[model samples]
Target chain A: MATQDKREDILRAAEKAPLLSPSAQRLLQITSAREHELMEIVAVVKCDAHLTVRVLKIVNSAAFGLLYPISSIDRAVSYLGERMVVGIALNDCAAHLFDKQLDGYESERGSLWRHDLQAAIASREVAQRARVEINPDLAFTAGLLHDLGKALISDYLRGTCAGLLAEIEQNQVADYLEGERHLIGIDHTEAGSALARNWKLAEVLQMAIAHHHNPGAAPPEHRPLVYAVHLGDIIAMMGGCGTGADTLRYPLDQGYGAFFDLGGEDLAAIMLDVQEEFAKIDTSLAETKEN
Target chain B: MSNIIIGIGDLGASKGQDDILKTFALGSCVAVILLDPKQRAAGMVHIALPEAKINPAKAQERPGYFADTGIPALLREMKKLGCQPNARGLMVKLAGGAKVMDPNDTFNIGKRNILAAKKALWAFGLGPVAEDVGGNFSRTVAISLATGDVILSSPGRPNWKL
Candidate 1:
């Protein structure tokens, strides 16, 4: 197939990728609202039985270390807090998509899911430390979905893994994304953006997924969120969470530190926090798997 | 046999012959493996940064996060496991410390990590007997307590002894 045709096919497949569940959509809407009313979020979460059950399971999980078993959605929401409840709900919804093996990228089963969670946590931390103007929830969501394209394009790459690896070695391709572009005519960033558009995700999220590898390419309006996700991805990789074949292939954008006015000390602090946060998440994930 | 995973900013040591100490996806970070062929003990530390002075608090909290602190910490733990300091029984191998990105060496964290690992080893009057370092690839390294062998694996590449 011609490169352009292959690109179009991948885009079509991405567009046809599974849409967000109704519960996830509602949770996203509730969390993304400008004004957060706990009651409003609670009402939205209660409408979805699966989301409610999953949220309860998470709160009651051994990792959460809750002192009491919570039987009701209200109690679970109140105990876990609104942001965590929303994150849990969305993660459950998205797990089916990201939890599979991505062998083309040399990722084991659940690697992408773990990476997304780590990046999401890191994004929130970066936003807080950098004092970026974007909402923390938006930054987290964008970070979680920034690599959605990898899931979309995994099948296509599986067939060409051997050849692509050779080309990458022979040409010294900068990273997997560059190799992806050379072999498939479109990179994960573009495919992820397309997936976001198909899911009708917020424009900021689409932009972040599209430009996370190159935040400078993002429009001015979306730069803050894009930059947050970009930094979060790097932080996740550095912390050794869910790294695959593309790990360490992307260069650190030095401009990001200058743009955010983040000194080395600031980054170190954020990294420390990210390590702690990821440790907690990993424990919870392990508990979930055990159950 | 179980594998003890050394995460980023962390280190692990095993005294049991059935245990394998391993670290994965070493990008710019370096994995320092120390083994005692006589005692059949192995230790691995995943060092992310070279110096600790920049973040003294972090260094104090996570000694395995920086080379200066991590190397000494690993040595201490290995000593507890009956690994000696002498050159006859103890063997060292280094893997990772790749400039995976930034061909221009703009950040150069990998190069710095390699240098720091060597410097710290020199403080102990030691050096790597075998090294597989400095490249554009990520590596997974493991040391077998039973065999005292260090193995390096990467994507699209065959696994080999270091």
Candidate 2:
């Protein structure tokens, strides 16, 4: 259980795990949206034929919260908007990459989907409050993808989730990072950072993903976005709107206080808004159950 | 061993007895605690919003979730229980006011709830002894009347005793 050994173990496991570079690369290329880059993403998805199918599946999936189903990829792109389409493409690529079910993480098939949606919504709302020049799209994308490493970890670890959960319960690990560090040899932050690097994601996003659990660990320049992801992760987990092993952990890093200028009442309002949104999602969950 | 459990959106407990005043999943909702050690009685309020002025009627229905109404109401209840405000050794502590919104994209509800609670306490000449407010995490907050210790639990976080 030594920290160094644990780190080594995690590095070994991560080394053997299938890299998400392909999906990450696809996302980076798709998100570019510049003249040549946009054409590249569009052409890649359009030409691949497989991605087109995956995009259609995601658009029509109940996970998208869409009222009506669409037929074609171009139509789906048009209906969802280019930005959303790009976001959806990234989501689909991630989903495809991690096709196998993740062990140790609790939640139904679409729990990850729900978590992504909630984080995106929460991120957009928080950015507005801070009056930061956040690309709602970027925030949403980051929020949705923040936990990508979780899926990778779960898939890679095989059956380690149950043991990890036991440790979390026994030690009262409020955050999964502790458990991940103890059991898996590497935490999601490092793995996520590696994946981000492999995918050629911007340095800021990679840093944000790595330091999301504790944005204060990152430098001041990257603090804003990482802080957003941290908040998004906390809100999503607390809402209980999503299912995952993380739902059990209630982490409160003291460093979180330094990130923002929030007082007690504003904190209350934020919780209220989060709860309000959760209520909406809860209704949806109920409807899904009723159906 | 018989502990009184405070349900969601509600707070009720007393000191010297095994009272557990709690608020579940407090997002932007404020859980305010007033403890009178001498009286050995404690009271809590789970305010849903920052101020009562937003909707007087709704405040009347859920007085526990508004700053203007809930704070006063909890104080009155504490006084009725013989825990006179400022008369007995009254110590106020506050928790819960989580930001469900993103730090970048959402309105600052956590900050708003804390501010409103502070203002209400200031108006009533009360101040908090300790506090843990404002974050993206949803908090399940409880107060132990036996020791007037406030306990908070959140996912992937440490518990705090304020």
Candidate 3:
């Protein structure tokens, strides 16, 4: 098939039938590129009580490590800047998009949420190491949203996931991209990139999500962040308590290690640090949920 | 019968025809190889976590578990094998920091493992002559003391040079 037709076919197959809410669509359309745009976005977010509550809670949470409590959107904006506000908004919208159902994957809500957070954190860390000029928040946001398509796929596939798990077991699928492509004709990376485009997200985020699963194949500029998220996902999955069918042992990419100038010693050290930090993050998240 | 398995949370050294270090299923786990060609001595450390600074108690007991602690421990083992830090034939090569789980956001233990090891090595004035890390893949690496050859074996792939 022609490349254009192929894109259409994949886009059509994405299952994004119910478009984003009218307010979200409006928030996405703001292209004034002015300071007032930030106010507009904040205003839209404030109108939704559920999203507002989540935003406030997250802004006040230790993740941001604010010195003083932030009770209002304007304060959060003043403290965190417009980019962080946008990120929180996007994060909130994305989380609300998925249902809590496991879709036979057996991953707990905490496990999934933790996985996303850790990967984003790890991606930002890698960006720092790589000295990539990309925004860490952008990388984090991309990392957080990278696996969203998997949730959609799981929801859509529902009971039929048994076959997917069987294939993973037989082939030892290293990443979800293979399974997504095998069963659904399109993988999560592509699905996520489409979602980003549909939401009118920034180009960097779109690039990161589309190529995160296979960073080596991404365009030159986005490769480092993409690679970071790719590795981050693996770390999160491994650290997670119960990975269920997602626990296939895939081989390490020879180029990926070299890309970061990491020799074996470096690789070993990074694992230790991430694991230790993950324990802390896991604990904090647990406490947050409990409260 | 003598594979000299490098058990979890452990380090091993071998020389001449008597050296073997083997580890299994390293995911978000790190395996480090320190070699001294002149003395024909080689050592391997397979450890989890980065350093004691994150958790001092764990660092004290599992010094071989963090890169900061573990690299020193591996160097000590290499020294026990008569390989000095400034020894002429000393070189380092590394492997095994495959992302075991979580495929999205970038909090990668494997990548972090690779990074911490590098920092520790720099502090010790050692550099990797070779390495492989950071992916959704697992790895098995072996270093031969006699020939100073490192062999990396991975799933769905044949054994080859490190």
Candidate 4:
């Protein structure tokens, strides 16, 4: 198939991809609202029994290391706070979106899920370490969904263009993202942004996902968030978290460090923290699965 | 048979004939494998950075995170496994210093890692007898202790001996 035809096919498929559950959509709406109150988030979460259970389980999980088990939505919200509560709810609702083998990207089943989770964790850490004014939860969400396009585009690429992408990567002709553009008339970044927009994700998040690989290209208003997610992606790869064929194929914006006033030590420290956080979550999730 | 996974900033050595030392998803990171067929011992280190001087504290905490310290440390560990370091007895192989990003990337970490690894190995009068380094792909490298066979695999590519 021609690159243009393949691109159009993939974008059309992404547009019709399964939407997030109604509860997850509501959580996103409440969390992204400008003047949301704690009660509003609590009410939204309480509307769904499964979401409520997942949130409570996460708050009481060993990962959080809470002293006492929290049994109620109100207590879970109060203890974990509104942003964290909503983040956990969203994570639970969207878990299935990434729980698959992405053969086009050479990612095993659940690898993309782990990668997104690590990126989410690292995004929050980067926000704190960079001392940026962006909301950490928003950064986490953007990080988690930045690669959503890969899930959409992978199957299409697997059909015929898989060999082309491999050749580009193997021969050092182009980075993976660029190779996508060269062979498919589009890249995951653009495809992901489209999906984010379709889901009614916040504009900032859409922009962050679109420009994560090149934060400098993001609109000035959203650059800080984009930078946060970009750095988080790099840190996650360095820590040997979930990775695929394109794991290290993206370039780091060299100017980002100076733009954020970050030094190597700060990055190194953030990586250590991300590792610790990922380990805790992994252990907790593993235990959850076993039970 | 058992397989040992070497994470970034980690080093592992195995003397069991059935043990396979492997590291996965190496990008701008180098995996140095040393095997002594005579002793049935193999060691691998996943080095993430070129030098440790920038972060001595980190190097001390995780010597395998930097090439400067990791290469020497892995060699010492191999020696401890009753393997001779001389070229005649030990087979050295290198993989996974791939510049997977754009060609114009400023950091050029993959090239720097290879340089650092080469320098470190040369200091010990050792060098890779076989190598599959530098490109735009992530790699998984594994070495069999029993056969001293090194296998390298990348996404969308066939596995080949290194």
Candidate 5:
């Protein structure tokens, strides 16, 4: 009934959320390490026969159009790299959250998956241009999972996306996040932060899920990764891949300038690149889910 | 009865009276609708950016992605349907150029897209007859080739003629 009561109910729902598959948990743990080797990811996949086949199938599955099909898991892991491997692991585990419709956002089924996929690709591209050394793979992983909380909140916000849009239109609230908080006790970022902790996700990832919409508020150490995901989410919206109602309603922190060396022109370039990459993976990953 | 759906960086045209030119979820992207008033042939281009220099290779592959090129590309599509567009006979409508509540966003692409679409139209001795652009919400557009009615709709909002 009350906003706080709703927030508590949402948090309790998150606490009961399904855990990521063991392989996915391992991938996140190793990828977040400072000096991890690629073999660490390969080892994790090797342990899960189902995940191993998904990885190999994606690499050879016309997605890459490899002339010679290599049957080795090690070669497949190296071929697609850590980011795609991480994506396969997580999607295998958390796809119900990723693929669910965001009725609250007025989005249809698969909208969240497409947005997160584009954000993941865009975040990886943005990280590649970071002024300081940072883990681009981790950025990709965080982007893919940043919007997980929206699915959790969608049921509660259903049938009210219009009123929220009007609130944004009249400038009664600064943006959708404000509208979300004003109506509900918490926004997607706060709800997602709870899920990240509930699942015992890596610390940097929790910061990313929490502060992606407002990276400047993130702690100084995790700011670079958070900023990468922040810009990535905006790029996905700009490229016309956002979830339905609340497409580009969040603020883009100008403070990201301190973390990355991207110019206005770079945003356009990243968007085009994201479009190209998204096309390549859209059907390929859909097949992964069906399998 | 039928729809010629245009995606970002994509364009389509139809001479059939049963056709509707449509584009969806236009966040910051701008959709340029061209209808030959006499022939009733219609076309649409979904433009994502103002200029091509940002990615020349992409412009070459999908000219509809940039406003400067998208306007001309849509015009070329109209010509393919054997309908020539003149300043007086052409019905032009522009929709979508929404911001995300951040006025200071250096990349206020919606505004930039509107300006560029206008500049590109003027270069071809054309201008919009009707437009609904610049807001903080995404738009979906449908142009009826049967009736010449341009319907602009936003999520949870009533559809209105542009």
Candidate 6:
């Protein structure tokens, strides 16, 4: 297909992308706010009894191994915390996109989700340890959705994986994003940004999806969050949880140092934490999927 | 054939001839494939870092996550499979350790990991018989115990035996 045609196809698909669940929409709206109360989050979960049940189920699942089962939705929210709540809601609402196979990238069915999960955890870790006052929960949300654009563009990228890698290696293109644009006239970031817009994600999240690979381009206020996701994404790839071919093709903006004052040791520690969190979350979520 | 997946920071050895030890998403990480041709036992360690000194506690918890500790951990696991990793009888093949983006690599971890794996192996009087390392892409590698075959695969690339 011509590049223009492929671009049109991806855009149309993004335009037709399914809307986020009402509960997820509300959750994002509440969490993305600069000053939202925990009760607000609890109220949102309570509105959807089924979501509350699922949340409690996940918290009580072997993933957490809590001593006693928590019967209250508020308790579940408090225990699993913000990231876990957001993750469960997103996974339940967007299973079609999250669960689809990325054949173009030669990635398995669950690889994209796993990669996002790791990035989210790493991003949260970065935010917690960042030099600035970036919101860790927001960082986790942005990280979780950073590579969502890949699902939208994966089909368009089928059979072009080797070519993309070669072009990237030869430096014929700047990076994977450029390779995507060169081939299809559209990149995963753009595709995902469009989806984020459709979902009415927060301005910070939309900016993150748009410029995760280039945090230097984000607005001054949101730049640190984008940097957090960028570092988180790299950390995930380094941890060997990439979605496939495009795993680590994007370059790191060393400029991130201005936002985060981390060293090799800090990152190594964060990776250890991410790995443990991922194993538990993935096992719990995988069990949920199986059940 | 049963595919035994060795995850990041974890290693497993199998004496079952039909078992294949496999690891995936090897970006900036290294996979050390060991085959004891004599005992028909094989193991692979997915090494994620060059040194355990970054976090000694983590290295102690998951030795397979760092090259310095991973090599010895993999050898110990292989030993449990009833195989001796002697210099003459063991075949070492290395794959992965690709630089994943960033020209000004702050960590330059891929290079460090490659060297660390080699140094660790050399400490045991072993060297790789075959290797396909240092690139700008992720890889999924598998080694069969039944045939001691090392198959390396990447997205959009033809699968080849190393």
Q: Model 3: runs farther than 4 Å from truth?
A: A1-53, A59-87, A96-99, A155-176, A241-243, A248-252, A257-259, A264-291, B1-162
- Cα lDDT tens digits for candidate 6, A86-126: 89999999988888899988888988898999999999999
Candidate 1 TM-score versus the reference? 0.88
lDDT of 2 by residue, B50-83 (tens): 6766556757766776777778877887878887
Please list the residue runs of candidate 6 whose C-alpha ends up more than 4 Å from where it truly belongs after superposition. B53-57, B85-88
Cα lDDT, model 3, residue A17: 41
lDDT of 1 by residue, A62-151 (tens): 877878788988887887776676667667766766776887777778788778888988888887766547777778878788887898
Error of 2 at B3 (Å): 29
Candidate 1: residue pairs that collide: none
Regions of candidate 1 where Cα sits further than 4 Å from its true position: A67-75, A78-83, A159-166, A169-174, B15-18, B49-63, B85-89, B103-112
Candidate 3 chain B minimal-lDDT segment of 10 residues: B98-107
- Over A90-200, each residue of candidate 2 has an lDDT whose tens digit, in order, gives 654555433334455644466666666677667655655554445544666677667667665665454555565566557666446877766666777787676676666
- Worst 10 contiguous positions by lDDT, candidate 4 chain B: B99-108
- Model 3, span B1-162: residue lDDT tens: 256777546788877575566775566667888877777878888866666576668778778777889888888877778887553467888887666444442436667778888898888788898888776555667776556788876434357878
Highest-TM-score candidate: 5
TM-score of chain A, predicted model 3, versus the true chain A, to 2 decimals: 0.68
- Rank candidates, lDDT, best first: 6, 5, 1, 4, 2, 3
lDDT, residue A3, model 1: 77
In candidate 3 the C-alpha lDDT for residue A276 amounts to 57
Q: Write the per-residue lDDT of candidate 3 for residues A1-291, one digit (tens) a residue.
A: 443554456576454545655554555454212235467767776787765665566567676576888887777656655434444445445555443444535444544455566676666555556644555555666666666655544554445445665566577554455765655566666876776777666565677778765677777866776777776665555543222345433333444654566543454445456555555544433444445
lDDT of 5 at A96: 84
TM-score of chain B of 6: 0.93
lDDT of 4 by residue, A6-40 (tens): 89998887788778888777877776656677788
lDDT of 6 at B157: 77
Candidate 1, residue B152: lDDT: 89
> Mind giving the per-residue lDDT tens digits that candidate 4 earns over B34-149?
87878888899999888887678878999998899998899889888887755457777889877635435443566778889999989888888888988656789988877878
Each candidate's fnat, listed in order, reads 0.35, 0.03, 0.15, 0.34, 0.59, 0.69
lDDT (Cα, tens digit) per residue for candidate 6, span B93-121: 99998876666756457777889999999
